[model samples]
Structure formats: structure tokens, C-alpha cells
Target chain A: MKAAVIGIGLIGGSMALALKEKGLIEKAIGVDNNVTHTTKALELGLVDDINSLEQAVQESDLVILAVPVHAISGLLPRVLDLVDRQVVMDVGSTKAAMLEVIASHPKRSRFVASHPMWGTEYSGPEAAVKDAFAGRATVICNREESDKDAVTLVEDLYTTLGMHLVYMDAAAHDVHVAYVSHISHITSFALANTVLEKEREEDAIFELASAGFASTVRLAKSNPETWASIFMENRENVLDVLNEHISQLRKFKACLEKENIEYLAELMANANKIKRILK
Target chain B: MKAAVIGIGLIGGSMALALKEKGLIEKAIGVDNNVTHTTKALELGLVDDINSLEQAVQESDLVILAVPVHAISGLLPRVLDLVDRQVVMDVGSTKAAMLEVIASHPKRSRFVASHPMWGTEYSGPEAAVKDAFAGRATVICNREESDKDAVTLVEDLYTTLGMHLVYMDAAAHDVHVAYVSHISHITSFALANTVLEKEREEDAIFELASAGFASTVRLAKSNPETWASIFMENRENVLDVLNEHISQLRKFKACLEKENIEYLAELMANANKIKRILK
Candidate 1:
């Protein structure tokens, strides 16, 4: 298969690498608006060649939209208009907005909405890594909207790459991602800001950061263009989760103020159930 | 040298394992209020034998108090009363309260207040693992209050375990830990509660939890008894950071509500500074 990956940053670049590594694609071509990313993706051997979106859609059997959430909403319909038998998919973090934008498109049947639930704090072509999508869950939104052949092609490709595929509606996917994914980024960013605001001593933060702190704050280092788009696209659900999160923190603070050890302990023990669920 | 680890749970059991693994102690003994812990520690080979607090103080050359913050605040001075040239230390999370509790004790010179900036979500004797302290920082608070001999012995032990030792005042230590450590736990626990409350679909969460969510929420799985005490003891500092964190989230929410892409992008870009510090 000849695959064309658009916006070849971290997710797209990594997906390109994974496809080539598994010999699933005969040739993987890269497409990006940024000249630096285009050059880096080529230099890093993430793609066999750099191609324009027009040319890539004409020649490739598979075309992937792996750009920021807002970019995906704007670009997917344009790509869908041009592709005939070529299978189109997006690896965006937010699905409902993007799906709604393309729902009325003529070639919507060729487009599959997918979110491979895996990412790191880094970005750009240079941040692309091999074996990036293994053993992670990928959520497929609005599967009923895509043609069976297109959906099966995307599913088989992800399965071949060792990802667990699950199905959900675009609206439900947005709500769940807000809870499981979007809020995490918000908390991490706020955490980094909190520490940076309060602790002026840089050396102390560097010296005292344990693995727990590092892991919890890792998403704080995510790309601004990407996350800001995600936060805006899923604004209502994000706000809902954010309000609940703040309320929970306030409860915790009140418990601590009252020295209510028993209640605080119960809260932590309840949260500890996440380990079993996560594992 | 002989080492006695009081309250042989996660921190104490891990310390005992490190001491034995590094061949720094000839024999390591366990002391805990719970008989089950003592038995489990022995069964797990974290200690050579179980000993009483008095027996541990009488026989061991180095005694480490690895109990909760509340217990450490009350127990440190009493343990110091029995000090007969034996260097004693603690691995509590809060330093200000513990240091204040033993500030005027005559045997303060024999006690060292150290907090190893390392831990996992798991707890109890079963959580003990070899090399837990490697490549982590250990902060020694109120160093001036400790005798020269006691400081030297405690520093040497941490150094032998491949840890970097940092010196800071008790108040400063509490503030930094609140910013770097305690607040992370609070955010994580609150995040878990937020998701649990908002997203009622348990199976969806189980299916959609990505590596990013797992990393950000890992601290939520921490032991209740241990964290409740730390939060209560460090309530003021924790509350201060928590308030700042809530304010930060509110700012992000408002920016999203207004679709202020510029401000949202700038906020995320500023948070990206954590990459430079964390890496």
C-alpha cells in the first residue's frame, strides 16, 4: 500500500514510521505545511518522499489526517472531496467536531474517524518515534458513516500494527475523551503553572522532582497549537470536567482544613480504584 | 553497620532492601506497630529479623523512621530520648511539623530530618523493591539541628544508596514539597474523582485510558493512610498551591469560553517550560 500522512508531526510522523517498519506500506509519502517538519521527516527517514496533498491523494491508497484538531476539521472534507477509492482516516484527539464538519460531505463514506489513544509531550517531525502505537487503544468514531471497505481497511491496518480497536459515537467519544484525555492535559498544564508560579527557586524544583511529579506533569509540555485547539473544540465537556475537578479539590482542601482524616482517607482509597481499572 | 527500619511499609521496606542490596548494612531489622507488617517484611526478606522499637534503638547503629507524617511528628522526640550515640533519621513527607515537634528536645542533635523525594503509588511491605532510592534526591531538613556525626552518617548512607542529598530549611522544604510533590497527588486524586463522577460509563473509561491519562493520574492510586497524614500536616502549603491551581484552570476555562486562541496558546507555550526543567 502507498500511504500519504498529512501534517507529519509527532502523530503522523510516528504513524508513518510504524507503517513502514511493519512492511504494511510499500511507500509512505509525507505532507506538511511546515518546511522544517517536511525536511525533518525526510531526514529522519519517516517517509520515502515528500508529496503535496493534491498529488498524495491522487496516488496513495491510504491517506491519513494527523494534524491538530482544528486543522483536521478544516482539511478532512477537502481531502474527502478528492479521493475516490482511497481510504481516508484521521488520528485526531477530538472527534465530534471534526466528524460533524465532514458529515455532509459527498465522499464522507471514504473517511474514517480514528483516535489512537497514545501520545507523548513532544511534537514535530523530530519527535516521531518507531513502535509508537503498539498495545494502545484506538477509538473509532462514527463507524457507521464510513464505507465498510474503508472502515475495514483502517481497522486491519491498526490491528496489524498491534492496536486494540474500540467503537463509539462521535458525541460519546468527545465526552469520554474530555474525561479521560483532555482533563489530564489541563491538570498537567495547571500543575506546571502552579509550581512555576509558587516556587521561584529553579534549582529546588529540578532537585526535588521525583518520578511521580514528572509523570503527572508530563502533558504540561504538550504543543500549544494542538492542545489549545483540542480544548476549544471540546469546550463544554472540558469545562464540565474542569468544574468537577475544582470542586473535588475544594472538598479535599476543606477536609484538610477541618483535619478530617477519616474522610480524606476514604477519598484517597476510592481514587485508588483507578489502579485496578487502569491496570 | 546495623540498620533498623521503623514502620516497614513502602519507604521503610524499600530502604531496608536498598541497604541490603548495597551491602551497607550487615543486618537490617524491622520495627512496626502492626505485627502483620513485621511478619510480611521478614517473609519478603526485607529484614533479617523483627525487633521492638526499644530493641531497635538499643542495638542498631542507624535507625530510620519511615512512618506517616503524624506518627513521625510525635515519635521522633521519644525515639531521640533513647539515642545513645546512634544516628537516627526519618523519611516523612512533611518537614516543618516534624522539625518543630523535636526542635527543643535535648537529643535533637542525634536526629536527622531527611525526606527522600521518591515513592510509588503502591504501599505496604509487599511494595518493597530493590534499588528504590537510586538516582533520586534525598532532602535533609534542619541540618543545623543535627550533630556533625549524625549528619555525616545519614548522608553517607543515602550516598551509598546512589542518591543525591540536598540540604534545605524545614519551612523551605515543606513549601517546595507542596509545590512539587503534594499538589501533584491532590490534582491526580481530584482528577480521578472528576472522571468517576462525570463519566459514569466505567467500561468506556477502562477501554479509553491512554498512556497520557495513565501517566497523569498515576498518583491517584497512592495509599490513603500515608497521603491523608501528609496532606493534613502540610495543609497550609497544600491549600496555597491548590488555590493557585484552581485559579489557573479557571483562566484556561475562560480563555476557551471566549475562544481566545492567542492567550490559550501562550499559556500552553509557557507551560512547555517544564520540558526544559524536567528533562
Candidate 2:
């Protein structure tokens, strides 16, 4: 099948690579607004060729949107307006904004809202990895709203790519991501700022950093443009999680200030419960 | 050289395994106050045998303290009192508090205060892994206070174990670690708590958790006993960093609350500068 992957950055590029690797995508055309990204995606062999969005959408059997939430929301209606029978899915982080924007589109069933629940700190075509979404959850929101044929085709392709599909409403999907994915980026970025502001000497962070610190702060290196668009699109949910996170930090701070070892141990044990869910 | 590894837990046991793997320690005798850890240490081949603290200290050419900070600080002086020519090193997280505890010991020159800048969330002898310390920093604090021969022994052994040795004063080491290491644990635990409280359903966390969330909150699963001891031992430094960290979080929250995309992007861009230090 021919596929058109929009954005052609990390997620889109990776999707192309993974599909082509499995021979599912006989011809994958890249569609990116950034000339550099389009050139890099082709140079990295992330796609078979580059094409205009109009040309790619008209010709491909599948159109995958992997741009930032704002861009996806802006382009979804236009893409849906052009597609005849092709299935369109987005791998953006936030779902509610884009899903709501295209809720009343005339050809809504041809569009599927999907988040692959996978990413890395780096971005652009250079950051794409083969089999990036394998063994990770891919949430398909508002599946009941889409046509059965379109949903089945998307699910089958994801299954072939080694993903476990979890179906949820767009609202629920946004809330879950805000709790898990979006908040992590904020915490990591904030943590990186905390260390950078206090630890003036760069050599010290380089010399003293361990596996724990690196893992915790790794997300801080994410592309600001992409994340800023996400935080803006999903402002309320992200704010809600950030409020809870700040309160949690305050609780830890108070325990440390009072030297309440018992309370501190209890708090850490409570946090350890995350292992039950994470591992 | 023969080495007696005290505590026989994660850090100590891993040290024993690395030393044995490199043939740096011909005989590794494990000394642990906890019976289960001692048994596990021997069963896992983390050490050649188990022994009492007195016998181990007396028999070995080197005594490596790999216990919680509280235990290390409490036991350092007594161990030093018993040592004749054995080079003693404590691989505890905090340096200043423990260094001050045994500052005036007649045998202070025989003791080297070291903190291996590496660990996993899990603990106990079962958590020990071969080559755990390789490619990580091993900070030797107040090295000038330790005898030349003792300091050289540790530096050489750590070098052989594939570790880079960084030298600093005890106070400086404590402060730096509070920023780079201790605060990360607090942030991760707080983040875990935030998610646990908000996402009541365990399945949602599992279904939606991306690599970003898992990596950022991984430290939350750390052993409470080990972390509580470090926070208490480095109370002042930890409190200092915690205050700065909370302030940074508050800044992020205010920016998000205001829906100030420009400000949030700028903050994340600033944080991205951490790539310079971390990589």
C-alpha cells in the first residue's frame, strides 16, 4: 500500500521506517512543511520519496499525521476534505483538541485519532528509529465515530507493527496523557532548569551525573516547539497535573525541612507504588 | 588484593562483583548486619565468603563501606579504630556529614571518603550487577586528608574497575550531589505520587505510560531506607536544592496557568541547555 506520512519528523519518520521495514508500505511518500525535514527524511531513507501534501493525500491509500497537536488540528479538516476512501490517523500527543476540531467534519469516518504512546527526547528526521512503536501501547480514541473499515485497517496495520491497541474517548485519552506523558516533560524540563540554575559549573554536572539523574532529566532535551504546542493545546489537563505535582513536591519538601524521617520514608514508599504500574 | 565489603547491599555488593570480575580482589569477604543480605550476597557470588566486621576488617587489605549513609557515618570511626594499615573507603552518597563525624580520628589518614555516582532503583544484594560502576564517576572527597598510600590504592582500584575518579572537598561534594542526585529522587518520587493520586486506576498508568514517564519516574521505586538515610545525612544540602526545585516547578505552573506559550517555550529552551552538561 502507498502511504503519506505528514510532518516527517520523529514520529512520522519512524512510522515510515517501521512500515517500510515490514514491507507493508510498498511506497511511502514524505509530506513535511519544513524543507530541511523533508530533505533529511529522504536522505535518512525514512521514506521512499517526498511529495506535496495535496499530491500525497490524493495518491496514497493511508495518510498518517504525526505533526504537533496544533498543526494536526489545523490540517485535519483540510486532509479529510481531500481524502476519498483512504484512512487518516494522527500520532500526535494530545487528542482532544484535534478530535474536537474535526468532530463535525463531513467525512469524519475516514479519519482516525491515534496516539502511538511512544517518543524520545530528540526530534527531527534524524531522531527516528526503526521499530520505535513496537511493544508499546497505541491508543485509538473515538473509534466508534470512525467507519468500521477504516478503524479495522488502522488496527490491523498497528498490530502488524507490534502495538497493543487501547480504545478510549478523546477526553479520556487527553486526561491519561496529561497524567503520564505531558507531565513528565514538564517535570524533566523543570528539573533540568533546577540543576542548571543552581549548578553553575557545567563540568560538575558532567562529572557528577549518574544514570538516575540522566534518566530523570532526559526529556528536558525535547524540542521546545513541539512540546509548547502540546502544552498550549492541552492547557487545562496539563495544568491540573502540574498542580498535583507541585503539591507532591511541597509535601516532600516539608518532610525534608522538618527532618521527619518517618514521614519521608512513608512518602517514598507511597511513590514506590508506581512500580506496580510502571514495571 | 583482598577486600572486605561491608553492608553487602546494592553498592557494596556491586563493588565486590566488579572487583572480583577484574581480578582486583582475590578474596572478597562480605560483612552485613542483615542476615538475609549476607546470605544473598554469598549465594549470588557477590562475595567469596561472609565474615564478621571485626574479622573482615582485620583480615583484608581494604575495607569498602557500601551501606546507607547513616550506617556508614556511624560505623566509620569504629572501623578506623580497628584498622592497622587497611585502606578504608566509604561509598556513601553524602560526604560532609560523614567526613565531619570522623574528622579528628587518629586513623583518619587511612580512611578515604568516596561516593560512587551510580545506582539503580532496586536495592539489597539481589540488585547487584556486574560492571555496575563502569563508566560512572567515583568521587573521592577530602582525599588530601587520607594517607597518600591509601588514596593511591583507591584511585588505582577505581581506575582498574573502569571508573573515572573526581576529587573534591567533602562539603563541595555534598552540595553538588544534593543538586545532581538527591533532588532527582525527590522530583521523581513527587512525580510518581502526583500520578498515583490523580490516575486512580492502575491500568491507566500501565496502558498510557510512555518511555518518557517511565524514565522520569523510575527513581521513585528506589529503596526508601537507603534514600531516607542519604536525605537525612545530607539534610542541609538536600533542603537547599529542594527549595530551588520547588521554585522552578512553581515557575512552570504559573507559565502554564497563564497559557503563556512563549514563556513556556523559552523556559524549556533554557532547560534544553542541560544537554550541554549531561551529554
What is the DockQ for all candidates, taken in turn? Answer: 0.84, 0.86
- List TM-score (chain A only) for every prediction: 0.98, 0.98
Best by TM-score: 1
Worst ten in a row by lDDT for model 2 chain B: B252-261
Residue A277 of model 2: what lDDT?
Answer: 86
lDDT of 2 by residue, B113-154 (tens): 888898999999999898788888999998889999999999
Candidate 1 lDDT over residue span A1-279, tens digit each: 999999999999999999988889989889898999999889999988998999988989999998898888888888988899899999988888887887788998999999999898889999999899899889998898999999999999899989999999988999999999999999999889888887788999999999999999999999999999899989888888888888998889889778899999988888887876887
Q: Which 10-residue window of candidate 1 chain B scores lowest in summed lDDT?
A: B192-201
TM-score of each: 0.98, 0.97
Span of 10 residues, lowest total lDDT, candidate 2 chain A: A249-258
For candidate 2, write residues A45-147 as lDDT tens digits.
Answer: 9998899999999999999998888888889999999999899988988888888888899999999888898899999999999978999999999999999
lDDT of each: 0.90, 0.91
